[model samples]
Target: MTVKQLSMPDLVDACVQLDIGHVGLWREPVRAYGLEATAKLVRDAGLTVTTLCRGGFLTAIDPAERAGALADNRRAIDEAATLGTDTLVLVSGGLPPGSKDLRGARERIADALAELGPYAERHGVRLAIEPLHPMYAADRCVVSTLTQALDLAERFPAHQVGVTVDTYHLWWDDQAPPQIARAGAAGRIHIFQLADWTTPLPEGVLDGRGQIGDGSIDMREWKGYVEAAGYTGPIEVELFNEGLWARDGREVLAETARRFVRHVIA
Candidate 1:
């Protein structure tokens, strides 16, 4: 069991207390402390770094910017390797400014993935495509469901391409469980992410992460499906809440660890 708070302040405390992990950090956090230092902190704390929070945003209207995105992502892969993380959560960016055609946006993502997949494979890391909730379809990601992510995954080698099923985004989806099961059967379940969904989104359709069992997600049933699909990986919790982030980082970590054990696996 892992609590994915993703706030810089709470990370190490979760590592030491929960003994699983508390955060899935972004590059900014890494940069803040310097990559090597942060990696050392994560290691010294004995936290299991599941997957780096992000690594892909290879969609841009300008050709040069798109190239830059891919180039930047390669560095992200390298950073993940340095951290000894085996997966880099790939968030396929949304459509370019003023674009409404989803197919075109999807093509951009697939193309970027095709270019990066082999590289990730060589580095002994897998790229996990995170399909955002439909609410973010227009601005954050075009692939807004597990089905769509799986479809894109099929285009690459299984060892190189996989999908991330975030509970916050997919819990409401009737088709998510089956697709997740299928992904498990196909050996494409790279990461199992959990985030309870709360009402009154903090970011207005952007923030809905809650502590495990604090919201409406039925983890017992969901975990059952994941196991039935043959996935026996770590369950990572990823949450983004201003209230949590504003608290003492260490306490946040300790509490998350307690709650994860109390509710997630109790």
Candidate 2:
């Protein structure tokens, strides 16, 4: 959510003005604006909904908690189908309360996927499992590498489940490139996202993603990796920086587009 500060209508207008034909939407804003209405808004603007951000967090030791997670994901799937986007990026959950079992936690995610994957497929959607950085392992996601994500995704059909190759999280791993190739060979690289890692991460590391070209990542290099892997889908720029948010949303959107051209496209 690079321009999370912008209202849905304003964001839509910005995209149209900037000739941004496709958008990756987050669930909160879409739900707040009314799902059907958002679907109509984007549809009427002739903008494609690229992918729905997040329908995971399946790790839970408690039975009721696990059921709630699955139910929420089902709603997310329905929302994705309603929004006409086939990809649902998942941030599989972390360890449950007082639990130190990482392996057990991941297994729960697989169990949830087994139930959710077919439901998603029935709605013309695919579940894209996104592995967060290892730093997020304890409380955000246990799948912290492309290899781990692929291990989970391979259990299901490629069309029903796949992995999200996000530069922000995977850039640190030397093994990611080969994993990208592996994912591509199986047609499981569902979506590719770009975000730069900046130094001196803020207290809230979640919002520390930097603007393209403003950090250490070679955006074009990562782009090349995904392309070499035969991922021809939309390349989404998803930043989470509070600094950018404090600035003008429209201006940030325009700037991000320019940065994409400079750092990724060129």
Candidate 3:
């Protein structure tokens, strides 16, 4: 009953060999292996895609770019549906470059999502708003807390909107546990994402998420709260560390699975 860390077939095959329980994937992984090929390999290899790690970032300075972002999100939603994945984790894009008004950027994000609600419903995918770290407020996400995500999700109904809880961004917030509980009570706990925080953050820290157990987060305690609130879904590992990415992808995934099972999962 522990969380699993899986990637595409090569990484997933490595994870399965180590007995990792589930995997989180992205569009590029599909593109690299081709969706059908990746899916079939996952089936034959006995791996499950716990969640899809992204499908947001509709931020732009002009109407045309905004339109393009929205269109891209729609395609991402459809891709999630096509893959038979249940949760579409959203990394809501932050303020447009050179934009000083955070609120204005948030409004644009909301409006774009409002427009996409109906389309997402038809695709049978729920848009999980994942608030990024406060550090990312300027360059990555304005939605930086679970409370904010829940509030925004309230604007749209359950059929269209939900909340994503990612430890990398939320683990330090005092309000995080209660927010996790609230998301569960409201049936909006659409996805549970995992990562640890490390020192010496990178220059472009959007990819700063740490591998499990390599940093300071206590996921066991974090998981206790979510489980207490009756959350019943796979715990997805989403490390974005440059070092891990620099290594062999298979070795990285395998070690991620090992740490996830030994430290984060029981």
lDDT by residue for model 1 (3-118), tens: 23344435575466555553466777787768898888888787767788788776787899998999998998888888778889988888889878789888888889989999
Model 1: residue 88 alpha-carbon error in angstroms: 0.3
Question: What's the ranking of the predictions by lDDT, best on top?
Answer: 2, 1, 3
Task: Give one digit per residue, the lDDT tens place, for model 3 in 162-196.
Answer: 98888888988999998888888888888887888
Using TM-score, give the best candidate's number: 2
Q: Which ten residues in a row have the lowest lDDT in candidate 2?
A: 199-208
- Write down the lDDT of every candidate, Cα atoms only: 0.80, 0.95, 0.78
Where model 1 places Cα greater than 4 Å from the true spot, the runs are 1-10, 21-23
Ranking by TM-score: 2, 1, 3
Superposition-based RMSD of candidate 2 using all C-alpha atoms, in angstroms: 0.5
Models 1 onward score TM values of: 0.91, 0.99, 0.89
Residues 1-266, candidate 2: write the lDDT tens digits: 89999999999999999999999999999999999999999999999999999889899988999899999999999999999999999999988889999999999999999999999999999999999999999999999999999999999999999999999999999999999999999999999999999999989599889999989899899999989999999999999998999999999999999999988887
Cα deviation at 175, candidate 2, in Å, is 0.2
Better of 2 and 3 by lDDT: 2
Instruction: For candidate 1, give the lDDT.
Output: 0.80
Off by over 4 Å in 3: 1-7
lDDT top scorer? 2
The better-scoring model by TM-score among 2 and 3 is: 2
Please give the TM-score that candidate 1 achieves against the real structure.
Answer: 0.91
